[model samples]
Target: MPAAGSGLYVGLMSGTSLDGIDAVLVDFSSGTPRLAASHHVPFADPVRAEALALCAPGADEIDRAARLSNALAQLYAEAVAATLARAGVPAAEVEAIGCHGQTVRHRPDAGYSVQLVNAALLAELAGVRVVADFRSRDLAAGGQGAPLVPAFHAAVFRDAREHRVVVNLGGIANVTDLPPLGTVRGFDTGPANILLDAWAARHLGEPFDRAGRWAASGSADEPLLCEMLADPYFAARPPKSTGRERFDLAWLERHGVATRRPQDVQATLAELTARTVAEAIARECPGAAAVCVCGGGARNDDLMARLARLAAPVKVTSTAALGVDPEWVEAMAFAWLARQALLGRPGNLPEATGARGPRVLGAIYPA
Candidate 1:
């Protein structure tokens, strides 16, 4: 049997944001894995459009999703090649590729989550083993099958002397609470960039508000912000996971967002994310001494400032301060998950996912 954590691995992640694919080459020979190289490939306009459409129910869904999966597999393969080349490594040298396929629908309540990818095709194209469909096994084991990175977070970011919270601000925000001693837990805190990105694309014709500049230009509507916080998902307890299907543009419209000025609405959305995350820390991770944020949202100066103010007394900073680039943390996480799965080690944290117990995640597709 191959030794655990002894080789290079590639991780691919295309989050709910639909921003694009992030691929990373990580060397795991040492206790602290080194990020060898990373590459990002933005989704072409049509692909992004199709993917956004598929997030909701639509006509001829099966056929559309299947074709899109193939296209995404090709993209994943290309990303692997790019990242490996950047690291000056060969495909034969890597053990496997861990791919978190694009999430079109995640309804853990109904006991299913759909992440689109063609793992076999990816393995063949990349000439490396592929481990994917990571959530289903946890779901089968009666877990929410999400916030899977808490295990990885515990392995890497946990500090023994002080409690810390690691938040991944992707399309959706999730928090992992690492107490100095106790069961580590995590859950979705609510919308992060999912709504912000959609709102920006709709009004600004831009992919997202750079550094949340447009939002910073306006003020948050207090009433609107309060109403957004009333979302039931915000009140739901841990072991929960959510996605674009629950917090999309339609959600904004139903909450009377149309009447507000676009920039003010943007500001309100930013507040919603910041407040929810801060509140979650207060409620679930009390006494957290520090918070390290990783994901695209870390770059949003406006959002980061709001988070700092709201999560006061608890120092807030990006994961880069802790040695991992914020943009590539999630990609690196899946790489760690692949290593766990290949070694038959449990990847899902029982406390994090509310699973009956720890479970090995993903299906392996040999090269």
Candidate 2:
């Protein structure tokens, strides 16, 4: 059944995956949120290439980033239109749109993170108020300005009856531990699909290791996995986060991954993702009752199988089993953030993002 509401909102997300834009129409008139409709608009190859290029040194980056931001807004607008159409809902009914533009680079320690998007352009194109740039304020308040969805996860997925750990496996993997009685704590576990996808693209000419089949074909290089698991970032204390800046293709090559068989490397990368995530849960939320995963990694069977094995004795399932689809949970988070901003509530969890206190996130662009 479709979500029903007196007022609706839309969420647009282009995550670190660089896959595309995911737009969701949400009905929040009810005390709890519900998904109404969704649409995914993929980036054209040129746009995707340019966005990736901007991640590292390149010529004309200032001008190129500007152009890419405009292009992203256009795509976001199209997604919003498609979502509204799918729901048979009109723009006039939507109170606002929350958009988490594609993240090109993240360097929280330096006190800055950039998720490139033109919110004003999106408002103009979609003809609706837009709330975006959701991390800056958290950074200003001394936070990582990332892994912002833990607050949303706690609000929606937490089982008052037991402790729950929500793990999101995007390009980077992050974990949110919601204990039965305490402030939520979440942080990036370590590299997830970012390395696996990059390796697959380089060796197999594919976007990702679909269902981790390529990885399943080979065995993990245990030594390499041990070395990667030993990295300081893996053991980094909470309130920390990382991104393309720290774990990119360059980092992988420097770690001697290029010398191995491509399939073995893929298997090792899969193990690395699972190991780091499982470790983070054990380290941060000991005695966690169940693990609920979201994000692109949830679909990778090979990776999921490994995580289940590593997290034995503790139940593991996707957020879908809890109510929301795994792929769109992060997108829904931004939608919820937009509502928070409109209502003057804090969106960042001080414990999760390591902020001094709760902070209302996002900048609003008027229609």
Candidate 3:
């Protein structure tokens, strides 16, 4: 595979929520890569605040964004160092690092999606070749350029006997439905933790409602939930994608019903996430035998309980039951993506992400 110079690599991801950075170590051997180790590094308070502020639309924000990007690259480098240390491996032993970067803006249909990461800075700091900006290439090829992890999901979690649905409830909720032994399909269902986390930060002065305890303490506003469910995105077909640009604080402020109790709004937002995801499954993958939930939303018991109610007959379980830690699945998926890039293999499923055809995703950067 490419003359045998490729060695180990690390993948870094900081999703829309600005929660933390997930770093994973990947070792490519015999053409397929194996996961060496993974680690999570929480964002410093000021950095997180700056990142969140940059996600929204505003003029004269590019300077702050540039600084934040450099800071993020340094943080990513530190995460790689810690992960490598935990695995007892040196950075010199690794080949390159694939960083998804923080997705500040993702608009595939407009032929661009900006993932804020400084790969050059990362390479300099980590002392390794760095592959970043994985989405724009696919968008240039007229693809949604999202749910990119489904290719990796198919590689690691596909089952032969049972048709399954893998749901990653990150800032936005996306699902990949794998048929028993054939093709796969996926798309963004709706908002996951973004709305909930933003509401918590505004109302409770916390980053998130841990285990959805705030939601559990209140009752769902049925009318509000119904109005949110009426959004056209939920009823649209697959191969679609969305981000904070469409479902952020401002959007919620304009569309979400104003209520007196903050807890009620929290409960409604949780319900909206669950209901939309369940509706997507029922409409798109009626034959799914089981649903495996992953990402940060899986930790929210209130959200999970509501999902269980919406998608009956299909057993709901966490990705942990299938040998993948829920918190690390997205980060680990990118590690697998790095391996696919090195192997010259297609990283997007045509049926899943609406790519014109199978295309090997990502580019190589020499160390």
For candidate 1, list the clashing residue pairs, or say none: none
The TM-score values for the models, in the order shown, are: 0.98, 0.97, 0.95
Ranking by lDDT: 1, 2, 3
Give the number of the best model, judged by lDDT. Answer: 1
lDDT of 2 at 229: 77
For model 2, the superposed segments whose C-alpha errors exceed 4 Å read 1-5
lDDT of 2 at 162: 87
Could you give candidate 1's per-residue lDDT for residues 196-283 as a string of tens digits? 9999999999999999999999899999888888888898888788888789898999999888899999999999999999999999
Q: Candidate 2, residues 1-367: lDDT per residue as tens digits?
A: 1123455889888877788888898888777889999888877889888898998878888888999899888889999998999999878778889999888878888899988998899999998899999999999999999889998998898887789999999988999999988778899887888899899999999889999999999999999888877779988799889988889898888779878898999999999999888888988899798999999999999999999999988889999889899999988988999989988999999988888889989999988
lDDT of 3 at 145: 88
Worst 10 residues of 1 by lDDT: 1-10
Which residues of candidate 3, in runs, are more than 4 Å off? 1-7, 28-34
**Judged by lDDT against the true structure, how good is candidate 3?**
0.84
C-alpha lDDT values of all predictions: 0.92, 0.89, 0.84
> What residue pairs clash in candidate 2, if any at all?
none
Give stretches of model 1 more than 4 Å off.
Answer: 1-6
Tens-digit lDDT track for model 3 on 227-254? 7788889899988999988898877777
